[model samples]
Target: MQDEKGILIVLSGPAGVGKGTVCNALREKNTGIEYSVSATTREPRAGEKDGVNYFFKTKLEFEKMIEDNRLLEWAKYVNNYYGTPIDPVLDTVNNGKDIILEIEVQGAKKVKERYPEGIFIFLMPPSLSELRTRITERGTETQDLINERMTVAQEELEMMEYYDYVVENDQVEYAVDRIRSIVTAEHCKRERLVEKYKQIVEVE
Candidate 1:
């Protein structure tokens, strides 16, 4: 195994399930990880920086990227286009830093189809009722939108079994720690770490 070939991780979950928060915590714990930034046709919100929060682009520009086959996976959400740009993500993964893609279930499914070796993690809420409560507590969306999201959450949750690991976002710290452990354990896989151990054992 090459040291420069880093792990590619896909973290997927429903809205308001705390996947972003957990990814932030995980990055803090492990500095070698890089989070993948998505490209979007949506305009940046207040205090959002270009290229950091997201790669903001015009709809025409985004459409060109889709046409050029530059996006790994693109989807239309709420009349706007969002996608994972392929080049930057591949660069980070090749540089020996674990690359994490925080995306929806559909995008994640697309990634898995392309990179079958990638690690997929599904984040979940404790239950449907708890998820509804969390979404409502955010205070960002109206009641009708919340209901729609809750229904979508149910569909996303049904696809959890497709992931390699499942972490429940019932508690923030616990969920982050569990995800970190998964990443660490994956690094210790026999195919990657056994040869190093063998070399050490043969040392004088």
Candidate 2:
């Protein structure tokens, strides 16, 4: 697989759909998919480090990055900006390493427009009721905030129709297995490997 360009795996879904949990589990398997850390203008919480947790940037610096076309996709939330840096992602795949981006649906859509060849997987809740339950169980958000998230989640879930694959997050392990399988299958697609065979046969 290293001989070919690495695949870009985009995992996204509505908020509170366990996208992070599934991605973390997949990484723990040591399957060699590098997780792309996002840049943000938000202040870091306790024990969070720059670059490892996120690339912390001042609002001024972040806006500059956006102006310079440094970010693949960006969005402002709660008065702060968060986005994926274009360089690290491109560098990883160009150097023959797979990269996984666990992002919001809006960002994922933007990434797809840039890299249509990328594998886009949407994580779904078992049911809308279940999604509400998961959000409510977080217990950290205020009631109004939770309601806002649910409204946003509804809109994000509708975007699933644009994705290449959908995996239900009924359980973390199961969702992880499904995602890994998608990546493995994508690597074997003939369209992606035809060039190597042609080169071996010396076809023009």
Candidate 3:
């Protein structure tokens, strides 16, 4: 049997669902996991560094990537484009380290189509009210933008049925543990590991 390939974990949900927090906690606990940083055409905000927060690119450069088919999945939001770069993710996965991608529902669906073996997990809030409160607590958006986000989030939440697992993130630590468990369980699938152990039981 060939060496086991790394798992590609695609996590998505509505805004304020704490996907980033859960992923960060998981990485903190397991240093071997890799998190794929998405490329974006949006300008970096204060304290955000290029390559660290996102691979910031100009509109023209982003369009070039789209034309070249370099992005696994790309989408326009507001006035800018955001996408998951294909090469980086493939490289990490090929090296036998799990790659976790936190993307929007649309991009996540596209990834599922492209990589059928990838694991798609949806992180949801305990309730819509709690989600709204969390968004407001961030205090980064204006009232008008916040309202728009809430509307968009409701629509996104409806797409959770498409995911392989729906994890309601009520507590940070608990959510992180659940996500880790899912990854561990997936790695233990008989279909993925059985062939390697077959020779051990064969009579000489």
Candidate 4:
């Protein structure tokens, strides 16, 4: 049978919801899913390489990409541009390789508008109190910033209704298992394999 096109998995959630941790653990399991690297106009830090860590670009270059509609989803933050380049994602999936995009809720929404067929998974925290604790433990934000994040998180949580699946990130391993099961179930979906199977039947 012919291989089906891989699914685009969009994992997103509120700040401090452990989206990054869950993605890292999932990838470490050798699940055969590629991490989608985004392009950015921000200066690359030490040991970061182009096309590997990110597709580093100049402000002008990044603007051109936005104008050309070459990005699946783009966002501006602190005067820097960050976006997922559309070509790489299409290339990876068309080659029958699953790719996971760990992005913000807003960016994920933009991606959905363009690629509605993508598998959008929302990583949910156990509770708002736990989410606040997680952000506090990060130690990278001020009290005021933490408060702001909590507010934003509440809004993001409300957006979970837009996602296809919601995986609770109470434990990293458990979340990864749920995601893996979702991927397996998506692959086995009859609509995804029907055409290939029909070809096999015709051949027989």
For every candidate, C-alpha RMSD to the true structure in Å: 2.6, 2.2, 1.9, 2.3
Error of 1 at 150 (Å): 1.2
Q: Where in model 2 is the C-alpha error above 4 Å? A: 43-47
Write down the lDDT of every candidate, Cα atoms only: 0.85, 0.88, 0.86, 0.90
Ranking by lDDT: 4, 2, 3, 1
Ten-residue region with minimum lDDT total, candidate 1: 1-10
Q: How does model 1 fare in lDDT?
A: 0.85
lDDT of 1 by residue, 105-189 (tens): 8889999999977899999899989989988987777899898888888888899989999999889899888877888888988
> Which portions of model 3 miss their true places by more than 4 Å?
198-204
What tens digits encode model 4's per-residue C-alpha lDDT throughout 1-204?
Answer: 678999999999987999878988987899999999988898886677898868899999999999999999988753578799888899999999999998888889999999998999999999999999999997877898898888888888899999999999999999999999999999999998999999999999
Candidate 3 lDDT at 47 equals 74
Off by over 4 Å in 1: 1-4, 193-204
Top lDDT hit:
4
Count residue pairs with overlapping backbones in model 4. 0
Worst 10 residues of 2 by lDDT: 74-83
Q: Candidate 2's error at 85, in angstroms?
A: 0.4
